[model samples]
Target: MTDDDPISLPAHDWPEFPPGLVWLVGAGPGEPGLLTLQGLHALRAADVIVHDALVDGRILEWRRADTQLEYAGKRGGKPSARQRDISHRLIELSRDGQRVLRLKGGDPFVFGRGGEEAQTLVQAGVPIRVTPGISAGIGGLAYAGIPVTHRDVNQAVTFLTGHDQTGLTPAALDWPALARGSQVLVMYMAMKHLPKIADALLAAGRRPDEPLAIVSNATLPGMRVLETTLGTASHDAEAQSMEAPAIVCLGRVVLMRQAIDWMSQLQGNPPRNPDPLGGGARTTG
Candidate 1:
């Protein structure tokens, strides 16, 4: 083939996608373009696909015409499929010789319960492969102009879920420890209990006025970033009527957004470089 030909590479360069096995893939945070090449390959090759609630439906447009799509999304307080049932279904599909694809939103291993499903499959002797995707904690925050780490701000960052399996604040989390130890905190699925979670952080000595940002529907067309503080996050979120599938970040990194809010700049807003810390402007000799 000539250099200008679209099909210049041989088919052998592609990896083998064997049947009767399951691939756990992360679809990334809401953006269809964020889906990895491996994930797209599996989508086109798999006989069946079991996906989560946060996955963008448009990503499935590339799937084969005969691909079987199964919805196993779990949203807090919404009627959804049970995790146990979903895991069992994967095992059943694999045993039936189907090339199953367990697709999840964000990194499957990051608060996606992918480990549990993988364990279940291992115990049942089902073969599996794992593909990592850009997590909302990282990608979504970037879309809102918030970085998880910056040398001038913090050296450590913590990522945690706002709730546990019971849909309440994770009781097992040592709130005081996290409050005292972490430089930056990135939370997922915490909006429903923002009041309680905020109280815990405050009680553990986090400043009420600490810079905090809530990014909803991150990386998607409807994305919104709310600039607030630890003290007013819950109230502001309520007042603004923010929705779920959001990422909440706290610490000086949130302030950096003022200088590098690229998304807003793309929309014609000017960049801002405000004082992240309230130490006032510096004076040099």
Candidate 2:
């Protein structure tokens, strides 16, 4: 193919996606374009795809015409397949000599239960391969014009799940240690327990006025971002009725959105806060 044509590697260069093998792939954070080349390859080659709720439909369009698509998604408060059932299904599909592709949203290892699934697959003696995709906490935040870290703002950032299997804020997390250790905190599945989390953080000595932003439907065309403070995050979210499948960022790096909201600039709008750092000049941090 010419330079203008789509890049297509020789078949020999691509990894073998054989029948009876299961591939666990990350679909990225809501954006079809964010899917990795390996993931795309598996999508096109698999005989059947088992996907979660966050896997974008556009990405699935790349699958082979005869490929079977299965919805194994788990949405909060919705009727969803249990994790055990999903894993067992993969094992069964492989044993049936199917090229099974288990597509998850974001990096499979990052709070995606991919490890648990992988373990189950291994225990069942199923051969598997993995392809990681950009996590929502990072890519989603970037789409919202918020940086996870900046030298002038924070030296370290922490990513954590907001709740455990019981649907409550993770009690095992050391609130005080987290508050004192990380300069930036990116939370997943936090909307449900945001109020309790905020309370724990406040009790742990985090500043109430710290900057916080909730990015919903991140990286999607309909993405929405709400800029608020730690003190009033719950109240503001409640007032706006913020939805799930969102990434919550808590740190000074959130202020960077004021200067580099590329999404707004892409629409020909200038930065709202030309001087977010309060010194009358623009800076990335």
Candidate 3:
């Protein structure tokens, strides 16, 4: 096999990608290798792929040369296609006997609006297949050596979008409840309103010095992880020019990154701290 050739997988037990069916596949974080086997199969078999803004371009290289690629990504503060129109186009394409693939970043159901699209397809009597992918809230954090749930840290985790349809902080969220209820909070697209979110959490009794980590371009070559406190997250991100397409993790688990940053270990750089919890020093044999 050559470098340009598409990575192949065993076809055994794989479902056939028939015409007039829409497959909603998650592309995982930003790493092409993270694409699920089912997702890759859909990519190769689909006649057209309607992908989101976060789907990495490298993953598209696996699709057949003749497959049609459509952009229906919706980014904050940008001019983008309407959700209804995008769903309508999917129905139109499938009705035209094309194998339609809706590729989204992370799990489609996790703040990716895959549920809405699935509902639209079902209501329109369109056949569809759903493929779940690793969410950024979990997988992205893992890439940064931050676990969403830790036995010693958090027993519960909450995942929420930073904004609602109006492009503002979700007003319906009970800030006090979230502050006290969830042990760890994973926020998506929260960079735009980080300061406001921090203020709300602080007002709700969350500690100002609560540990937080912002992971940018997660699982990709340019991935960056910033460790800061809840009070300083907004200002620190701005001072460092942290960009979007990032994941924000808030809780004690953020401290665990100091001990288990395995990616750095691969390059002969040991973790900065071996005992993040301060239980005792861990010895390397």
Q: Which candidate tops lDDT? A: 3
Give, for candidate 2, the lowest lDDT window spanning 10 residues.
1-10
Choose 1 or 3, whichever is better by TM-score: 3
Across 97-167, the per-residue lDDT of candidate 1 in tens digits comes to: 99999999999999999999999999999999999999999999998988899766788999999999888
TM for every model, in the order presented, reads 0.92, 0.94, 0.96
Q: List clashing residue pairs in candidate 1.
A: none
**Which RMSD does model 2 reach against the true structure?**
3.3
Would you list the C-alpha lDDT of every candidate in the order shown? 0.90, 0.92, 0.93
Global CA lDDT of candidate 3, please? Answer: 0.93
Better of 1 and 2 by lDDT: 2
Q: Which tens-of-lDDT digit does each residue in 1-285 have in candidate 2?
A: 122433464565778999999999999999998998888888878999999999988888878777899999998879999999999999999999999999999999999999999999999999999999999999999999998987677899999999899878898999999999999999999999999999999999999999999999999988999999999999999999899989999999999899989999999999998668775553555
Number of clashing residue pairs, candidate 2: 0
Of the candidates shown, which would achieve the greatest TM-score relative to the real structure? 3
Backbone clashes under 3 angstroms, per model: 0, 0, 0
Ranking by TM-score: 3, 2, 1
